[model samples]
Target: MEASPARRPHRLDPAGGCPHAVNARLLARGAVTPVELPGGIEGMAVLGHAALKEFLQHPEVAKNQRHFTALREGRIAAGWPLLTFATVQGMTTADGDDHRRLRSLAGRAFTPRRVEELRPRIERLVAELLDGLERAAEAGGGVADLRRHLALPLPMSVISELLGVDVEFRDRLHHLSSVVVATDTGPADAVAANRELVAVLGEIVAAKAARPGGDLTSALIAARDEGGDRLSHQELIGTLLLMIVAGHETTLNLITNAVRALCAHPGQLDLVRAGRASWADVVEETLRWDSPVSYFPFRYPVRDITVDGTLIPAGTPVLAGYSAAGRDPAAHGADAGRFDVTRPARPGSVRHLSLGHGTHYCLGAPLARLEATVALERLFTRFPGLGLGVPEAGLTPHAGFVGNSVHALPVLLRR
Candidate 1:
């Protein structure tokens, strides 16, 4: 009952349009390209790894809303205020001394010991989810929607439990968070979702304040930086919202993208299945080939700066094309687009920018990586006969300015 070689999942459709390809073409022309964002905001898209690293390290570049060119110009239109301001007070959007303070306090919550302690719990949750998937497949003609049954719920559950978010509120939170990141959401929907997200976060913050629990939310309620500065009420709500949303979104994409990459290349999957290539290798290669985050938005220059022979004026919004940098031919050579699990760790090869860089690098990286590695390995092992239930061309791409994920992965749990 094995799927034939010709039945393997293939690359995305040519007509569907790939943001990574667009960015790669831009990078090939030059390290920096003039790009326009929503609201008619003009900025330079930093393309290759060299330009991306330099852009991240540039002192003039800041992450706060006060410096957002589009917001400041009053051009940020409707349908985006949620994403623009959702994490406005969290470390994700803070810069300078404020960034350091927020990051330091949040960092304590994700220490090595804390993350390690959660591994057993994560594994248990994965097992429980897979058991449900198996049951669904058994009762429903051998098919399963891996995205919902496995990829989607695992990270959300892990993060929700980590933050002590009640199970009942999870579905609503997921909807709001999805709208915030989605570029294609309608204006009315975005506005309503934004309001609901803020209200929900406020409720959670108040509850945690009244009754401290053994959870990250409670810890953040009490968390203070080295300077004796604690998070404000707004900061607490923003930080918790950021943690809950970010904790799952990126990792969800990572798992989905990795699985799709493997299924698309049967030979590579065989290597992984045969134990020739490690799961860690699969994870790293996927990050390079199909980055979870397609591009990150709006880093404003504190002052005019020249990058890769291009001059970016002060306060100009600079967007980092992380997915494009991952496949930069100059950095990763001509075969950068090939999905190879056996790819060598060669010198001069471009290191992936999927997870950000420098001081503001993703804080939950370890937990994300661990969740992905465990999820993928256990998934394939539990369902060795898995194959695409829907054609590759039919799979829907994630509809967002950032994130490279499919809408759903309809998979055969058993051949």
Candidate 2:
């Protein structure tokens, strides 16, 4: 049955966190469909390519929590798993001038020049990680979980090094961050994770303030504004948390998804081998094929808003259905479901909103693209015969609606 109404959105894929499945169901209903969040929370999902792009740039909507009436009125109870997205003071939850202010400060470390400069370091890191992967395969008799051996560590190390997050805190933060993003996390654990995430980041910010270094954390700490415009203590910690989670998690999955896609569709890898496509094509296609972030959370409408006849009540969180938009058949054509490295770009529109659009666009996008591209090129070159060690069905989706990726990807370095 179709969604009854925006007030009672159709139930989405709760047991399985497959975006394509969810997208297919929601897309069949309409461009904008109301859906139920994990905690019995009602929200709207924009799953169409055209409609999602429009709403992402919609002037009527804002991501700031102040506009969320349910939250402000305490209707959204404490310990809700989705509260982190709503209560976090980072740019992800900020809108308007506040967003601009926060984004401006964080953007300094991720400029084209800065991101390009990291290319050399990233290459070195990729090389080292490949060595680790080789060791893992040797120990495992030519089998390895690439996600654990390579994909996860690459971005985690890069972001941690860039932000100067200590190695000691990396694993701790990763565990906490995983819980914070996963929808299926239990209420009590979710609340504890959110609180501990803030506490951990607060310690990082405090350390940076005491003895600053030539790192993003120190730079953000030192950034000041005339007329009392500055990143407050809470905002500073939130920014660090945002950088760690957004910077690492998104790119980790991007690399993982790209590798998974290429391995699953070896013909696409053959195309790259025949000079029909480049690693850049692989990266972009993977993004369009299996977007890392599935349903980016919590863009609230200041007033009741209607998109293509579906009404999203004011103050209800609107999840951006990015993974759905990536594979929308309407905009991408009937063959959209098939992964094509040579897929033609849709004219007059941005390639895809995987990295988002307009003002709230991801600040670390360049870095992410660079990391994925370099990592893929080096990985494929280093392990020419790499293939999945397990059946396709063996790959399991993470138990979270917001993040779309398999929990683990096992592969054979050589068959």
The candidate maximizing TM-score is: 2
Candidate 2 per-residue C-alpha lDDT over 160-273 given as tens digits, one digit per residue, 9 for 90 to 100: 999999898999999999899877777789888988988898788778778889998888887642327778777888888888999889998999999999988999999999
Tell me how many clashing residue pairs each candidate has. 1, 1
| TM-score for candidate 1, residues paired by index | 0.91
The whole-model lDDT of each prediction reads 0.77, 0.86
- C-alpha RMSD of each candidate structure in angstroms: 7.6, 2.3
Clashing pairs for model 2 are 9-34
**Residue 157 alpha-carbon offset, candidate 2, angstroms:** 0.9
Cα misplacement distance, residue 326 of candidate 2 (Å): 0.7
User: What is residue 208's positional error in candidate 2, in angstroms?
Assistant: 2.0
Q: Model 2, poorest ten-residue lDDT window?
A: 1-10
